[model samples]
Target: MALMITDECINCDVCEPECPNGAISQGDEIYQIDPGKCTECVGHFDEPQCQQVCPVDCIPHDPGHQETREQLMEKFIRLTASK
Candidate 1:
C-alpha cells in the first residue's frame, strides 16, 4: 500500500525530501502524496522514507490504494523510466 498524508500533517516540510520516489509535494494546506508515483519505497529503501521522516507521524497506509510488491516495483520503474 502507498502512504498518505492526513490532515494532521503540520506542513513542516519534513517529508518531501525524504521520499525516494518524489511522491510527496507541498499542497495548498498540507503536504500531499501522489499515489501514482508512490511505491512505498519498494525499490529504494527498506521502508517508506516519507513515513520514517514525518515528524508528526501523519503518514499512514492508504487502504484505498492497496498494491502488491510487484505492482509497486512496476510503478517505480515507470516513474523513473523517463530519467
Candidate 2:
C-alpha cells in the first residue's frame, strides 16, 4: 500500500529526501505523498524510508490508494524502468 503524511507532520523536511519514489513533496502546509508514485519502498527497501525518518511518525497507509504487495512491486519495477 501507499503511505501518506498526516496533518501531524511538522514539516521538518526529513521525509522528503528519504522517499525512493520521489513521491513526497512540500504541500501548501504539510508534506504530501503522491499515491500513484508511492510503493511503500517495495523494491528499494524492506521498510518505507520516509516512515523510517519521519520524526513525528505521521506517515501511515493510504486507505484510498490501497494495493497488494505484488502490485507495489510491479509499480516499483515500472518506476525504475522509466528512469
Candidate 3:
C-alpha cells in the first residue's frame, strides 16, 4: 500500500528527503504524499523510508490507496522505466 502523511505531521522536513520516489512534498499546511508516485519503497527498501525517518511518526499506509506487494513492485518498475 502507498503511504500517507497524517495531520500529526510536524512539517519536520525529514520525510520528504527520505522518499526514494520523490512522492513527499510540501503542502499548503503540512506535507503530502502522492499515492501515484508512492511505492512504499517496495523496490528500494524493506520498509518505507519516509516512515523510518519521520520524526513524528505521521506516515501510515493509505487504506484508500491500498495495493499488494506485487502491485507496488509493478508501480516501482513503471516509475523507474519512465525515468
Candidate closest to the true structure, highest lDDT? 2
Q: Give the TM-scores of the predictions, in the order they appear.
A: 0.93, 0.97, 0.97
Candidate 3 lDDT tens digits, 13-79: 9888888899999999999999999999999999899988888888989999999999999999999
lDDT of 1 by residue, 24-78 (tens): 9998899999999899999898898888888888999899899999999999899
lDDT of 2 by residue, 1-83 (tens): 89999999999999988888999999999999999899999999999999898888999999899899999999999999988
* Candidate-wise lDDT, in order: 0.90, 0.94, 0.93
Order of candidates by lDDT, top first?
Answer: 2, 3, 1
Which window of ten consecutive residues has the lowest lDDT sum in model 1? 46-55
Deviation of model 2 at 60, angstroms: 0.6
